[model samples]
Target: MTGWTAEDMPSLTDRTVVVTGANSGLGLEGSEAFARKGATVVMACRSVERGESAAAEIRGAVPDATLDVRECDLGDLANVEAFADGLHEDYDAVDVLCNNAGVMAIPRSETADGFETQFGVNHLGHFALTGHLLDLLRAADGESRIVTQSSGAHEMGEIDFDDLQHERSYGKWDAYGQSKLANLLFAYELQRRLGNHGWDNVISVTCHPGYADTDLQFKGPREMGSTLRTAFMGIANAVFAQSAEQGALPMLYAATADDVIGGEYVGPGGLFDMRGAPEFQQSNEASRDEATAERLWAVSTDLTGVEYDFESA
Candidate 1:
């Protein structure tokens, strides 16, 4: 297809897909689409009530939708580990694992692991979850995928090895950018490692939602107490942001597209990659730095204690 949208998504019969932050926004939209295509979606969210409600709404729309609402708080490593363990006990194999949960720019804070909130939750949390579930992903009957959600903001990011947590100084946007950049780095590095180990069945891909209008935008302004910025965001979202469904197209495409290759980055096709149909896109040079990616991987493994046994695969 020249242009890709949700309508182009292929059938997902008998597929077991896992989506983090699946209660709302891009995650919810993506989960609903997967269910519509016949995949049994596991909705991993922080709140059980919201997750059940989202699952019900999807079931209401698609009567035969197969959905499971599971609790997972990405800000806490313990919770992520427990969630992964539970998935292993219940599911035999996983067809797709979409690391779609994340936090954007907000007041300087830390996760339960004591790392900076954005870096900890956005990058490290997903890293640990993927590592924990690596066996299930590898056990799939056929090709399986790990699609990570990155951002356009990654273009401005720089990873500071000296103070990775931003305890010395913190700029919300900069911290957020670093986390997004880390997402791409992790995706690419994972694909590379998989290739090195001849694990070609598991493809690692990355995507961005562009400027999607969702509750994720409000959190930063709310935490920072920036009334003016909050008002501006409200207006900008109305005027510039794409709907959550539209924003989810890139992720959906990355997760299901037949032509998708490992280490590829997907995003909007329109101007500035803000909004449009899903298409193959480019990430910044910083995101592609091999040395930095290796260093970050080592740090992440140390921080979360979730070692990826690529050699064994």
Candidate 2:
């Protein structure tokens, strides 16, 4: 494909998609793309007012777009569970789940569940949400997919099993890397488990935005009140980053592309995989360790009290 775009997305009529952080940035772009293609989209946000505004903007352009704004803070497991329960109650099945919301290199913090902020919201939050929605995904009439957003920073990540929450020492980038790496590990491990359990219709995949110039890029610096860092990042984003729309192509490809299969990691194909067409890419060796994956799965289940029931797989 010389140029792959959202225009290439297949008709998603009658499908229902849930995109976390759909209130802004790549999530907003992706949600709009899906809605344009005729899918009902659930914009899962941490704030209801912001979510409604985003949905209204989408409706202004696509008047018939089916959009629902739901509040679900990824850093809060209670909110995640409530959001999942409401979704299950309202919809018979979910065709796609895009775990796209995340925080960047912010200062050390903890989620409402007492886990590291980045790890809690980026990895565990989506993990628990997916577990809660497994049945709805399985109920889809045809193929169903889960796309967990990962990142290139994952190359620097090392899951400190002993200090998962960085209890002893904390570096913002270090924590962010670990969470992104965990995203890939979770996605691949979920795929393997699905295959083992013979759940051919349900697939798990992973993707990265590839330096998208979105509001998220500034979250960390803003949160830390670092004007210089924020300004530098803003300039860097202008010079080196792709638009949020372009950055979202990889996830869209992984979500609906006919050639995609379970366990694939899709990202940009341009220089350093930062800004180009979506293509299959390899994650770091650490992210591929089976033992780590297994251990993480067990730890996650215990931490979230939500387990993937592969009994019907």
Q: Estimate each model's TM-score.
A: 0.98, 0.99
Error of 2 at 262 (Å): 0.3
- Who wins the TM-score comparison? 2
Best model per lDDT = 2
Mind giving the per-residue lDDT tens digits that candidate 2 earns over 1-313? Answer: 3489999999999999999999999899999999999999999999999999999999998899999999999999999999999997899999999999999899999999999999999999999999999999999999999999999999999999999999999999999999999999999999999999989999999999898999988999999999999999999999999999999999999999999999999999998999999989998899999999999999999999998998952
Q: lDDT, candidate 2, residue 287?
A: 90
Error (Å) of candidate 1 at residue 296 is 0.7
Q: Worst lDDT window (10 residues) for model 2?
A: 304-313
lDDT of 1 by residue, 126-190 (tens): 99999999989999989999999999999988899898999999999999999999999999999
TM-score, model 1 to reference: 0.98
Clashing pairs in 2: 197-313
For model 2 the local lDDT of residue 84 reads 95
